[model samples]
Target: MTSARRTVHGTTIGIIVLDTAFERLPGDIAHAETWPFPVQFRVVRGVRPADVIEGDASLALAAFHEAIDDLVSLGARAITTSCGFLAAVQDELTRYSPVPFFASALLQIPLIERSLPAGRRVGLVVSDANALQERHFRNVGAEPGLPIAELPADGPIRANMRDNAQQVDRAAQERDALETVERLLAAHPDVGAIVLECANLPPYSDAIARRFGLPVYDIVTLVTWLHNALVPPRYRV
Candidate 1:
């Protein structure tokens, strides 16, 4: 076993990502790139939702394990996946590796839910509502019947947002996000916080928080929490 002292700051982090063709999506990968820490990442190419769920679940686990092992070989202390939808395999992935692993940003839901007051609720803003399940919410410790908003899944809008990167039309994304939040808040007026389920939504977090006048959580914030927890500066050698 690697001694605790040997594993301290010598640890790196690996991020397993899908092989999407889009180049401008500035999600967690971007955050990891600029993270002010000594971490490394390895992308496990060619893994997609359809292949993982329909082709073979074990294949997905195999790919995830392969990436984790590669990172571990390079001295990674922990692992994190790029997409929230991967939370389904959180348990299985962790079982195959000894290092600390975070399945998705939504993993912060349990903490967010606990911090809210009674009658108030936590809401999720995701790119695709159809892909989300009650299990995803439950895995994160959210109460059943929690409100959620799906951004316009239209191809053109998504394509435009992805292509622009940080230059993405703030007004457009905020309009869509705000419309969804407004609709949810109208129905569930007690919701006190909003969680951005899509990692790409962080660039617009401040606007969403300012417009809704509520706390907003996104992958950037969630990853920051994970970074602090698993790789604290004090832990660095």
Candidate 2:
């Protein structure tokens, strides 16, 4: 019989991650580990941005599709990609896959917007502002030109976060992220909710919420919701 045909008390959710050497940046992996349901992972090798401006999405989709097939074979009930940029092909990916799939954390934008009153808006904290465009915003049912903020993943800022992930300077990384969120909120007072664009930032979700006094949404939360609905704990064996 097929893997999908086999029933278990719990269901597995597959996460497709980027091919990066960084081990501590496994936000998706960490999220899956903490999930209430069973989780499986399938990595796609060697997919990265070249010039920052020029992205090879075709290569990304190829890796993603291959990973999906493997996960389905392993009996994954649903799939979620690790990065927000993957939303570019979310519609296509979901259409092609037999299982439920979520491509981006920004998918929560529409729900967030609907929950809030007018004048108050959701803010996006992205690793790369230039890469986030109207296409991504609209995909999640967010208005174009919504309050968005970006912090480049470079310089001492990124270095601090990276070092913290390695356990070299945890305090420094926390401080840097806190400062960045403070600055972002100062710049956009009307932002009622915050969406963390970088998967790495979700670790500081509590900090961000406390500092800004707003609901914070990240890829982790999005995956958790999808996992719960698509693969409930009772369904896992």
Question: What are the per-model numbers of colliding residue pairs?
Answer: 0, 7
Q: Quantify all predictions' global Cα lDDT against the true fold.
A: 0.68, 0.70
Residue pairs in clash, model 1: none
Model 1 residue 85 lDDT?
70
**Ten contiguous residues minimizing lDDT sum, candidate 2:** 22-31
Candidate 2: clashing pairs of residues: 8-237, 9-235, 9-236, 9-237, 10-235, 10-236, 10-237
lDDT by residue for model 2 over 71-116, one digit each (tens)?
Answer: 8877787888667767667777888899988878888888998898
How does residue 197 of candidate 1 score in lDDT? 72
- What is every candidate's alpha-carbon RMSD to the true fold? 4.3, 3.9
TM-score of each candidate?
Answer: 0.79, 0.83
Cα error of candidate 2 at position 12, Å: 2.2
In candidate 1, what are the lDDT values of residues 55-99, reduced to their tens digit? Answer: 444567777888988778777777776677776677778788888
Candidate 2: where is the Cα deviation over 4 Å?
Answer: 1-11, 25-32, 49-54, 155-168, 231-237
